[model samples]
Every structure is written in C-alpha cells, then in structure tokens.
Target chain A: MSLSLNQWTTRRWSVAEAVDGCVRHGLQAVGLWRQNVAEQGLAESVKLVREAGLRVSSLCRGGFLTTGSAESLDDNRRAVDEAAELEAACLVLVVGGLPGVTPGEPLGSFSRDLGGARERVAESLAVLAPYAGERGVKLAIEPLHPMYCADRAVVSTLGQALDIAERLPAEQVGVVVDTFHVWWDPQVFEQIARAGERVFSYQVCDYLHPLPADVLLGRGMMGDGVIDFAPITRAVLAAGYAGDVEVEIFNADVWAADPDEVVATMKERYASVCGF
Target chain B: MSLSLNQWTTRRWSVAEAVDGCVRHGLQAVGLWRQNVAEQGLAESVKLVREAGLRVSSLCRGGFLTTGSAESLDDNRRAVDEAAELEAACLVLVVGGLPGVTPGEPLGSFSRDLGGARERVAESLAVLAPYAGERGVKLAIEPLHPMYCADRAVVSTLGQALDIAERLPAEQVGVVVDTFHVWWDPQVFEQIARAGERVFSYQVCDYLHPLPADVLLGRGMMGDGVIDFAPITRAVLAAGYAGDVEVEIFNADVWAADPDEVVATMKERYASVCGF
Candidate 1:
C-alpha cells in the first residue's frame, strides 16, 4: 500500500520539488506530470527522481485522440517515449472531448458527435498500443468524470474504458481506476472486478459536493468528502492492481497549501481511510 | 411531435403566466412544478391550465426517497395527490442524493453510503408506487446527471433508473429520459430502447459546457450546446414514447430573458433542432 503523491495535488511544486517532497515525507513513489517534467527537462527529471529513490508510479497524460489530429497522435508517441525514458508504470490518458468545442467558446459552435469522438479514441489506441509495448510502457486510459465529457475526456466510465482496452494488447493497453471519476457509477464495482489485471494504475481522490466554479478542480483530499474509499480501494486490490495508489487532488485550496503539509495529509489519510 | 414547456424554463413566470405563454405559443402542454402549484393554490392552478386548454405533461417532481424519513414519504404522498388532481401524465421523481449532506456544508462532514441511499429509494418506491397507482398517477424516475449524484439525484443513468422501475408495476412506474442528464452516457441509446413502454416522459435540453458556477443551471436552449437531439429524440420515439416532448432549460441567461422570448425560442428549437 505504498502512497504516490501526484504532482498536480501540489500543483505549484516543480518536478525537483515534488521529488524532494516525496523523499522528505518518506513516500516511495511520485506521479509525474508532462508540464512539470518539461520545465525541468525530461533527462534532468529522470535523474532527480532516480537519485531521490522515488518510483515513477505514472505519467500524467498522453491522449486527446478525439480530434483525429496528426499532431495529437505525434504528441502521444512522444509521451510514450517520455514514459519509457522515465520507466514509469503507465502513461495515463485523458482522451479529448468533442472535436470543435474549446472552453469558453459560444456553446452553439461545437460538434454534437460524441459517438464519433469515442470512435477516434479506439482507433488512436490501435496505433499507440503496439508502439508503447515496443518501448515497454502501458497506455492507461483514464475514464474521466462525465462532467468532463464535453471539455476533457470522452471516456467517462471504467466499463467504457475497459471495453476499448480489451480489444488491444493486454500488456500494452489498460485502464486507470480513479475513484473521484468512477465512484458515482452504478456499475463501478462490477467494472473494477472485470478490469482485473488490466488495472494499470489506481488513483485516489474524493468527489466533493457544491463543486467549485471550475468543476475540474473539485477533487478533495480523502476523508474531506463524501466518498467511501475503503470499499473502492479493496475492490482495486481485489482486481490485482499491485501498484502504487496515487493521490491526485485538483483543488484550488490544496494547490495553495504548503506542499509538505499536503503530502503529509495524503499519507495519513491513505493509511487510515483507504483500505489498503 | 407536440411540444411542452416545463415551468422552470421561465423561472420568473407565475402559473397563470406560464399557462398563458403556452397557449399563446400554440403549445398544447405544460409541465407544472409543485412550488408554482402551491403558489397559485393547487385547485386554482389546475383550473387555470385546464381552462387554457393546456395538458399537464407531467408534474415537475415527487421523490426524495433516500432520506427514508416519514416526512419525506408524507410529502411524496401529497405530491402524488397533487399530480392526480391535476391529471398529470406522470409525477417525475428526482430521488434524493446522499442523506445528511446539506449544500455548502464542510466537505468532510457527509455520509459515504451511496448504496444505502439508493436502497432507500427502492424501498420508498415500493411504498409510493402503490399509492400513486391507486390514484392513477405514474411514478416517473428521472436519472439526473452523474455530476449531481452527490447533492441532487443518486439515480444517474437510464439503466439504473430502469433497474428500480422494473421492480414495481410496469403501468405504475416508469422513467424520464432527460437529455441534459443522460446525453453523456455511452449506453444511452441502448438504455433508451430498453426503457420502451416504460418511458414516462421525454425531457429535452442541451448540456452546456464551461458549466456555470452552479452546474444545476448549466442547461442551454436546444442547438445552443453540443447535444444532438435528433438521435435521442428518435430513440425515445422508437421506444414507443408518444408523449409531449418537454423543453426544460435551467439556464440563468434564459431565465433572465423575457419569458415570452424564451417561449418563442423554445418553440423554434423544438421544431427545427429537436427532431420531434
């Protein structure tokens, strides 16, 4: 039940700072974000985390295939290369939403083709899966919350992500089970059991109520929201996910807190509340 | 293909005003909320709509069964009585979210028993369905969006709603297929087809992105957001739903506009974009 601190939980911290924070907190693993890795340079980030003796549990993201854009696919290939270079557990994918809708744009000017967007994700995976396998990286498709289906990932359920994953090479493609996104799902437990051995990463966070203005940042620290983590954590363990559980909160208040305090709280909550 | 205007679409309008607006717009049906019926006095509100030649498409809501409280059961009984008196096509049920979590409370202080809350909804339905059945009122379960799963409705998918609905008498219990709440569901079409004759109401609205500060009011007028209404509308129709399609927008901008103008836009959208 090793705890992994996802960098986004302490959003202001650099890769070097996150690595140091993990070491200071006696955490054995840290999840890396592409933005943070780029800031410190990928080679330098790898060296820093390795020297600090922290396992790279997962890479933040690498999918937006809904656009069917050449650039998106090319970028995903680069992300796979990065994940391989860092020797991370998996490259977590936040597949894109609708094709034409940018945030804050007039609502009328967007595609109404959700089916088309989802189809592209499956097709893009066919291309990325083997490439990732060749580089010894697993592409973990993360099913985001349905609230994000419009502006973020079209993959909105563990079952839906698994449906796509089962069609590809098992060693190359799988799903990330994030509690905050899939906790509300009626079929969650069944899906988790079905995702056995295909569970590439297990991410934890609580789904807070009275969601903030930006729902994207609505995740709260465990025990600070309505989610029951024990049952879900046990389900993930039952699914044979013998990997680090990453705590990935996207709260504005959390981002503003001292990174050290955040990591400390995460560790305490993980041990006490999350049934490891 | 007949269109119905849900009262909340014109939040500022009185029952009398809503009835008149429906009549003036050549709309034959109007959905009534309990608050508005109470505001105008139930008998008077019924008389007003009946005299205006407007059919009562459905009562706005009648379920908060998750609390398992005697008071909630009593209130639902009264709501059923109100719908029976008005001769609504059905009484829409927005089954309650988690118990004991008021909006804006400290995030840490809330129940984590989603399964228990949902069970209470089923148990309450067993009590209410027979009561509504004797009164010739159908209990229509409305599965709201997963985003609202914490504070609004725990029933967040058409399939989940059907699972509950199937346990009761088919003629007495059914489900409302609301576009805004269910459009993001990958299994929407399959669930809609399975809903079949159990489809009590067909609610239409667009799910706007860059959701407003209050996600509750983030609905948009048809064609103003990313929803493709034609396919969903067709699925409902194909499933043997022959009821009036209710235009139920909960947008702040729409609320602030002139009620008459809002009705006009609703009519135009229902005709052109909704594929009714």
Candidate 2:
C-alpha cells in the first residue's frame, strides 16, 4: 500500500500487533507514537518493526515547547533519541500552544500570550535542532489546524512552519504537511511548494465539521470527509516528497471498529481517494 | 459605551428588549441580525432602534454564495436591502463554504470543492457589490476561523477577505475583522493594517479552547478567554476602523443570563479588556 498506518489511527493496537498487521496488509511503513514505543520497550519495539520488514515512517510527537524550559527541551531531546534509535524518517513535533496551563484547563484560566508561546517554540527549536542533527533524526514540525492553536500546537499553518524550518538546515529541520490540519488554508498549495524538499512527512486524514463531542477526536477517514486527497497528494509529490503517506485519524467511531477491519477500510479508502 | 452589543450575545432578548437593554446600559450602537429584524417588522425594528438612539452598526449576514445559485445571490441582495432600509453601517456576510450541502448537514456528507466554493463567492460578490453599492450598504465579508471553513466561510484570513474586497470599489465591499475568528492568525496585525479604510466593522470576543459541545456557541466574552484584546483593539483602531466595536459572543451560559446583566457585563469587559 502507498499508505502507512499511523498508530493513533488504531490506538488499541499494540506496537508488535500493528507492525504484524502492516506486514500482513502489505503496508511497508508504520508511524509509531512515543507512548506505544514505551509500552513495548523502545528497543524491543524498534527490533520488532525492523524484523517485520517495515520502515518506521515517523515518530508521532516530541514537542510541547510552549513552556520553553529546560525540562521541556530535555524531553524533546529524548524524543529525538527515540526516533533515531527506531531509525524513523523524522520526529514529528506538535509544537504546543500557550504556557502556564494544563491540558483540559477551565476556559476562564486560559492564558492570553499566544505570541510568547510561539516565540518560545522557535527558541526551543533552536536548542533542539543541533541535538536532533547530531542524533541523525530530523525534527518535523507539524502545523496543526487553527482550532488547536489555544490548547495544542501554536503553529497553525504550513507557511508558519516553513518559516521556522527555514531558519535551520533543511535536512535537520523539516515540516509535516498534514491534510486534516491544513486543507482549509488558501495558500496551502503555494506553501507546500515552498516547503519543497524540506517536507519531512506527508500525513493524510479528512476534516469533518460539526465536530464530534470532543473536537480533537473529530478527524474523519479519507474519502469520508470533505478533503480532496488527489490535489494535496499531487502537491506533496510535486514538492519531491517521496515519504510514506501516513493516515493518522483520531476518531471515536474509527477506534471502536475491529483493528483489522479498520486497516482494510483505510487501505481501500486511500487507494480510491488518493489514487495510489 | 463605544461597544455595540451584537444580537447573538444576548440571543434570548427580543429586538425591543435588546435595544432597551443597550439604552439602559448607555450603549450607543447595536449589531443586528436578520432573524431578529425579521422577528419584528423590518421598518419597526429600524424605528425602534432609532427611537432608542441606537445606531445599527452592521447587519448580521448576507452571503452563503458557496453554492453559487441564483437563489443565494438574490437572498444576499435582499439582505443588502434590509441593511439599507435599517440604515446599518454595513451588512456582514458569512460567505458559506463548499457546495451542495445545507447548514447542519451530517459531517460525513460535506462537499470537498473548497476552491470552487471560494471562486463562487468572488463571482457572487461581483454580482452583489454593485447592488449593495446602489443601496448605500457596504457588504462586509467576515472571514470566519479556519475551523469553520468546511461549513461556514472559506475566506479564512483577513488577507483572503481583502483579496475579495479589493476586486471592487472599497466603499461597496469591505471586510469585518472579528477577533474570535482571527486571534490565532500569525499575520493578523499586518492584514489589519492592510485593511485600513476597508475595515467595515470591528467585532470583539475571546477564543476559549476545550470548546463547548456546540462549537458555534463557544465564543467567550472579551476578558474571559485567552485573547489579549488590547493589541488587537489597538491594531483595529490604528487601521482607521472608526466603526462601532461590536461584542458578539455566542456562549450558552452568556445567553441564559439576564439580558440587562449580560449588557452590563459586556460593558464592563469591553472597558477593562478592550480599553474602550
């Protein structure tokens, strides 16, 4: 399959099981998350995927630089280490939002310093880039949808991500062009072209509105939502991005389905919608 | 008060009651919605607000041209007529997204043709601009947050909105800069500056994440959420936007509050947070 199954797309599946499933389904790549790797012992997880004849497409995340503190930087370094040890293509960063609030904080307690949060992300990236380069793991900053700007990633556009990525070596720092987060952007195609060879990972998922009860879990499967995969996929290809196209959905209904069935459906949808 | 109370901020109140509430709170202006205008006879609604000494700052809506149908264009023309009859400063256009689906359509059934929808908006605007110009009503295209791009407005940035407005006479077509819909934008200040005299309306509200179940009703009152109002308010003022600053919240809790109390709170928040 031209698509790689991102671990979060099937959150219930174990690392070994996911790799085995990918092998059985003829998917050559898998995008694994940190927590899943920790669950099976990072070393063991790496060996299992490699033994299964699968490539680790990208690590799920390693950024929460909203705080821009030593501890946050250290955690990100460890994430880079993990990505390097697993021989993944890049360590995806969900560069977090404003500082001084925990996840699920009450609406009233939210911070108003978006500019400060964004600056901190740049500072943290500056500190981590050299470390990631040394470890031979590319840092892929993912620009999430603007809806996630308050509580999740402050980076909300591919152009914004490229702005940060351009400050570092292209091979060391890159951007992830996730369709679900960026499909609405008017300048998406132009920005993707600007990304060119610095495009580290190409993630696909569909955007469905009237979002589910929890908006974060509202990503729809490809072909089931409003995004046209062909144009975006073509853009990525034109940008010279030959990376695995990872399907990373976070939906309640998708997670509830049988794991194998979900893989089969994803493969079918990716093939039909992406023309892969 | 420099702040105008948008009709949806206290949605439960009738037109007379809202105007009375504004009068009682010493508010000089109001942002009226079409439904509320329709609730009372259009002429009566105009007479009532004028008698109460309240200026109708802007009409709530008039563009869902994403469908590009004759019916949609005609409806928008009528909205222009309503705004002119009411003597509103401008008619705010939501500029609906994608085609072939009605509002509140199941998320999975969304249309994927965003580029086409946006082109249709430009075409319809070209049609409506002259009509709105003749009526002395400025068509203010409100660029909704990108999250709303699937079902609401496809124009997701001030730059995108201006791109549409600049196609015609600046007096007939302008853009509404709503803080809630645009707080996360990286180029907000630059775009606002570019807007200059074409900024037809300045709307204020705060963005709170962990959105309420009904995301549409998630807008918070000025000081209660994550937005830093001073900078944005300053930017709008600098852009030569001398129009009434409207406080347009859609929170369920705010709606349930006593209309008088809500107006009082809006006045307080606008003064303290927006420095108005």
Candidate 3:
C-alpha cells in the first residue's frame, strides 16, 4: 500500500516546504491545493513537485457551488487547468454551501434550499466536466460531513454524490470516499460498493470528541476516533478501487506539532492501523 | 390549524401544571416523555392530562434497544404498558446505541460496532413489538441526527429507519420525521413520500449553535436555524399525515428562560413558519 500526503497534513508549511516535506518523508504521492498553486505559480509548483519526485495524487479542490459568481466559476476552471498541468490523478471538489457569511451564526438563514444548492452544484460540475475530461484529470466529488451542510458542501452522503455522478455524462466525474465524512452513514459500505469504479480516492480520517463549531480544523488522526478504517478500506478496495489510501487529517493539535514528527507518526500510524 | 404543547415544553413543570399552562396558552395537545410520567406516576399524569381536556399526541419514548438485560427488556415493555395506559397516539423510539462501556476510561466506548448496536436495537424491537401491538400504541422510530451515532440512537437517517420498518412483519413500526435531524437530507421529500402512513409523528425544529457537550439540553428554536420549515410541513401534510406536528425543542437557552414565554414564542413561530 502506498501513501499519499495531502498538502493539508502540513497546512502550516509553504508550498515549497510542503513538497520538500512530502519527499523527505518518502511519500511518493502528494495532493496539492489551489492556494499553494497560486502562491508558487502553477509551473513552478509543478516543477517543485516533480523535483521532489512525487506524483500528484489529486488537486485539493475546485467547486464551491453555493457562492457562485463569474469570478468563482473562472477560478474553478483555472483550478482544473492547473491540475491538468500538474498531471494530477483527480481534482477534488469541496462543493460550496449557502450564499454568504460562512455560516458563523447557527441561527442565520444559511440556505435551506438543498435542491437549489444541489442544482447550482450540478450546473457548475457540468461546466467543469468537459474541461476535466479534455485534460485527463478526473473530478472526484468529495462529499463533506453533514456538519458542513450550511457552509462547506451540501453533498453530505455518498449516495447523494453518486446520484450527482450518475447524472453527469463525464466519465471522469467520480466520488471521493472520505471516511471522516461518510463513516457515520449506515449506507456507507453499500454506497461504497455502489460507487464501484467511480471511487476515485479514499481519504482516511477520524473525528475528535467535544466537537467544535469550526469543524474545518477539528478532524482526528486515524485511530483517534470511532471509525473502523480497516473494514472501510476493505470495502473500498473490494469496490475495485486501486488508489492510494490518502491520509488527510485536519487536526489543529496534530498540525501544531512539528511537521516532520507529524509525517513520521502519520506514516507509522497509517500502516499500523490500516495494516499496510 | 392547531397548536400542540409537548409536555417537554414545560418539562420543569408538573404534568397538571404543564397541561394547565398549555391550556392557558390555548395549546391543544401535549407529547409527554417517560420521565414526566415517572415523576407524576402514570395514572396521575394521564388523569392530569385528560382532566385538562388536553390531547396526548405521543408518548415521548419507548425503544431503547441498547440494553440486553432481561430487566432492561422488562423495563421497556413497561414503557409500552405506560404508553397504552396514557392512550398515546405513538411511542417515539430513540433506538439505543452501545451496550456498555469498554472499561478503558470507565467511560463510553465510541466504537462498539454500530451495526451490532443496530442489531441489538432490532432485537429489542422484536421483543417489544408484540407487546406494543397488544397495547394499541404505534411505534414511531425516531432517527436521531448522525451526531448522536456514538452515544445516543444508532438510527441516524430516515432511509435506515424505513429499511427497518419495511423488514418488520407489521406496519405497527414506523418513523418520526423531525426537521431537526433530517432537514439537511438531499432525499427528504423522497423519504417522506416513502414513509407514507409509516411516519407516525413529525417534529418541527431548528438547530441552534453547536451545543456545548454540557448544553445538549438546548436545541435551536424553529426558524432560528437554517431550516426552511414551510415547504417541508407542506410535504409532510401532503403525504397524508394528519397527526400532531409535535414541537420538540431541546434547547437549554429556551429551557433556561420562562417556559411560558418559550411556549408562546414557539406557538407564534410554528404558526408563522409552518402555519400549523
């Protein structure tokens, strides 16, 4: 089993440091994000990743469906272009939520039109699908956890993601089965099975106790929470996916620790827990 | 159009006091929890409810399948007996989770094979179903939000609840479609439509801020969160459900305030938002 280091694992590290860190850790594959691509410039970021002898497993994200604008649409399409240039495996989509304010107040009118958000997301996906297909960079729709339904992505379940995937004509439009987002679902294994070849990437993660409102940074290290990763990984593999089980944790505590230590510990823990 | 005051609306009050308060506020029906019955004793509680000319829409609970001891089974069967005694319209089931603590921290086990928890719940349901049938109480399977998957009920989605309902030999087992838990679902209408006569009771609620682990007591009031309650109520009514649109708000903030004020505001909001 190979390991893919999501740049988010070392979120504190710069793009250059992130590439160097992944390489130093002997991680052969790395997923780069749009912000870093912008900072380092697409060509140099691509060059840096190549020099580090790392394969781009996936590009971090593209679609944020709710807060749609000409600028956001153009930016997402540009993200697809960058992924193609980097020759990444898939462009992971975050798929946005409500129109504004990032859902700070729980009581705000944060867009209850799930159908409207879903429609906008689907429309944006259609716009990006042709570009993704032409560039040979797959688009993996990452269904985020339900906690983020108001601000992050409205796609909270795998079956819902598959429903979206099935409607799209793009052969490259697949689903990213992140354990952190989907492990709570009773339909998880069944949906993973239904995903079949459409299963693009598996993001292994866990949740922490005393959940915080800013869930973006609260993700647990594998084996830290209740997820039975081994059984889930077995299901993913059994579904005909041969991709690297990408360890994508967003814990502030883990990130606050030294990057080298985090990477070393993550590798050992991933193999030990995942039985790699 | 009618207003039902769930006894939980005046949880801190005596059953008679709650009913009196509801009557004072022109609220028609009240859903009672097992605890309320325990506090007043069932006979007195029912006497109080009936003498007040109040409707008992549902008995707040029944199926807690987490327990396997013969004593626990007997206790739940007793809850059904009480529901029957009260002439309750339905028995809401927050089907149980992990059986016991794993002894590590002398604390709860977060990962006790949820599928196992589910089976235990189903088994408990099997044991309790016949008793419920004879008692003339309808069992409404309340699928708690996924956040409660570890500590509370393992039934987290309408789909899972409906699957269980479908497997049962009798139509006695159905579901409680609460907006608090399922409003974010992509297939809300689809599942509601499938629920048919099986949707026993519907709770119209809105989520407040992420509750502090200590303050799970206070949920959000209606129209105070991201829920678009209008169309959903329309859909549930459209699905041929003429049962009480029970307002079950577990909000500490509202609870901390005067129960009288809470009831009045909830009545106004429910009328304006759901037009009940």
Error of 3 at A25 (Å): 2.2
Docking class of 1: medium
Candidate 1: regions farther than 4 A off: A104-109, B104-109
Ranking by TM-score: 1, 2, 3
Superposing every Cα of model 2 onto the true structure, what RMSD results?
A: 1.5
List TM-scores for all candidates, in order. Answer: 0.98, 0.98, 0.94
Model 3: per-residue lDDT, tens digit, A180-213?
8887898999999999989988888776544544
lDDT of each: 0.91, 0.89, 0.79
Candidate 3 to truth, TM: 0.94
lDDT of 2 by residue, A5-120 (tens): 99889889999989989998999999999999999999899899989988999998899998898999999989999999999999999998777555466764456788889988
Q: What is the DockQ of each candidate?
A: 0.68, 0.71, 0.42
Q: Kindly report which residue stretches of model 3 are placed more than 4 angstroms away from their true locations once superposed.
A: A105-110, B100-110, B169-171, B209-218
Error of 2 at B12 (Å): 2.0
What is model 1's DockQ versus the real complex?
0.68
| Clashing residue pairs, backbone N/CA/C < 3 A, model 1 | none
Q: After superposition, how far is residue B127 of candidate 2 from its true place, in Å?
A: 0.7
